[model samples]
Target chain A: MPGTRARRSDAEVVAAVRAAVVEELAEVGLGRLTMDGIGQRAGIAKTSLYRRWDSPQAILLDALQAGFPQEQPTPAPTDDLRSDLIEALRLMIAWLTTPVARATGAILAERARYPELAEAVYTQVFEPKGGRFTGTVLRHYAAAGRIDPDRLTPVVLDIGEALVLKYTLDSGELPDEQTLADIVDQAVLPAADRPH
Target chain B: MPGTRARRSDAEVVAAVRAAVVEELAEVGLGRLTMDGIGQRAGIAKTSLYRRWDSPQAILLDALQAGFPQEQPTPAPTDDLRSDLIEALRLMIAWLTTPVARATGAILAERARYPELAEAVYTQVFEPKGGRFTGTVLRHYAAAGRIDPDRLTPVVLDIGEALVLKYTLDSGELPDEQTLADIVDQAVLPAADRPH
Candidate 1:
């Protein structure tokens, strides 16, 4: 009964650090995020954190990656590019409308000051998943003969990124299922129909 | 030369203060933007500045509004929706790539703390121009019988806002002229084309 409190494991400690970064970012914003604060919040020793991450920026980047969904959504072989694109758009929009979007915004703003953090994010978290998603959608469209194979990747990236950016920056409105459907019908499908 | 350096007029003082705000923002970012800094930089009496604006945010907002483009781009009716949309997108992309974009980003990031500034920007800068651009594009498509008359407004807003947001938030990559042309030919035209 005296030793009832559960001992936190190494993986649990890492998760705590990651969650603490998001909490601190939301509470105090990127301007005030510090490694010391993260250590205190995570209940981990400062030396332990320093050994793991070179700087607060590195910690922040790690936190962001840890927060991302483990299983990336893949577009199914719907054979209809429009439908598949719509579903993909919906998944992206859903992610943006969540707490993840706020954390992302903070990281992006902070990245202006810490170029290494930005590069890490671009290389590790942002680029890989976004690239994979785009590639999958484009390959499907290309295989179905819906879009020119050459333009598939660029078009998917452009349209998908635009949707996410628009909601995040301009309107602050989430692209709902209906909106995604409309975007696919109006923007993606038509673009795919163009002659090479 | 000493005589020429005599006390400035009211308009000159205002201009100096606005310029000081911009310069300070560029140097230290919005986090360090302050009225004291502005007064010192502009060589203006602090009392005079207080009389003009109630707070640093007010002064910054006024300066921002003064610097924003007053007139929206005129959408030329190219007799084709694709051409008109491409021209519009090009202009929008160019605007986002300028210094104004950075200033805008700072303001948006600050808006969570200052709601009044957000409202002012939305009403004065974003809403009016966004409405006009979306309306014009939709009108062009409607006239050509390319799109359903009813769905024109939403489609234009969705696509236009998406493109603008993409440039602002995600990659800062402006959709090139060729991409714009392709978007119009494939997406806009097809979306407008209804079932016969």
Candidate 2:
């Protein structure tokens, strides 16, 4: 009995651990994150957390992969490019302001310490959620020969995400309805629509 | 010695302190920045630093105002909006990747702790430098009746700067000539040009 292993390898434990990491990260941020604290928060034994993950960064990478919304919400197909882009960008704005994305501010600040984690967040989490807007919606528009081919690249796609990020960074919140409309009406629509 | 005031108003001392803050911020970033370290780096006393500024945030605000490039370089005039926008945005790309802009990544990371400092840096350093591109160059083009009046606003202006910042954040450097050209050609020009 003294040497026997307890019921481990439960998938629920993995989910709990990941949720604890994310919750702790949002509250205390990455600088002060600790496995002992995470184990406590998750109500799992310290030995359990240590057995599964090598470091806080390793857990963070797993948590990020789990915590991010698995699928970007598909925008409804509207005949108008403007409506489709607006809906897509609104989804992008909401995603950027999520607790997970907000928590990454701490990671990005400590990028020098955890370069791999930062890069993973950018590549694994951010690019895909943000990238789907262009890949799915804009690509469809371009395929219909509605948008200029020049506007189909990732660089052009960055325009909307960057605006939302910059606005949130400045104001500490997602932009309002008027601002989103301005982005879609004045920038996104103009930049993509093929000349008649 | 206590009776008499030491050389209290030397511009050189203030300049040295500000310069030291900027240099240290670039090298070690904000998390490791310390008043003692700044004093040592500036060859000034801790008492002197404390006397001038209440906290590191105060010093950072001062340094940001002093550190950013005062004027955005004006590109040469060209016949077409494409050439003009390309040259203007090239200057923008260079300006964005400067040490001062790169250093703000640290402040941005710790935005919760020092919101005012972040706002000050944004309003004073970033807005002015990034603002002029839209206010001056783009305004000139609009004035010439080459572009729509509705396009001349702060929101639309953010697209170019935001794109540059995103590219820098992702790649750890400014966009290349091809990327810059793509942004200007596909995004900026299309958004600004008027209908025939």
Candidate maximizing TM-score? 2
Interface RMSD score of each model: 3.5, 2.0
What is chain B's TM-score across the candidates, in the order shown? 0.69, 0.72
Mark the regions of model 2 whose C-alpha exceeds 4 Å error after superposition.
A1-12, A26-37, A45-58, A70-80, A126-134, A143-150, B1-17, B24-63, B70-80, B96-99, B102-111, B126-134, B194-196
Write candidate 1's Cα lDDT for B54-116 as tens digits.
Answer: 877677777766665432223444365555666666666666666655676677766667567
- Candidate 1: residue pairs that collide: A190-B186, A190-B187, A191-B186, A191-B187, B146-B192
TM-score of every model versus the real structure: 0.70, 0.75
Q: Candidate 1 lDDT, tens digit per residue, A1-196?
A: 4356688888898888888888888888877888889898987778889888887767777877665543232445435555556666666666666565578766666665755655677687766565433345766557666667765535444665565455555454566677667666656655555544
For candidate 1, give the lDDT of residue A149.
76
**What total of clashing residue pairs does each candidate reach?**
5, 0
True contacts kept of each: 0.47, 0.65
Highest-scoring model, lDDT: 2
- Give the Cα-based TM-score of candidate 1 against the true structure: 0.70
lDDT string for model 2 (A1-196, tens) is: 5447466567989988888887898888787889888998988878878898998777877877665553332444535676666677676666576665656666876677778877887787666654445445677766666676666677667666677777776677788888887887777777766464
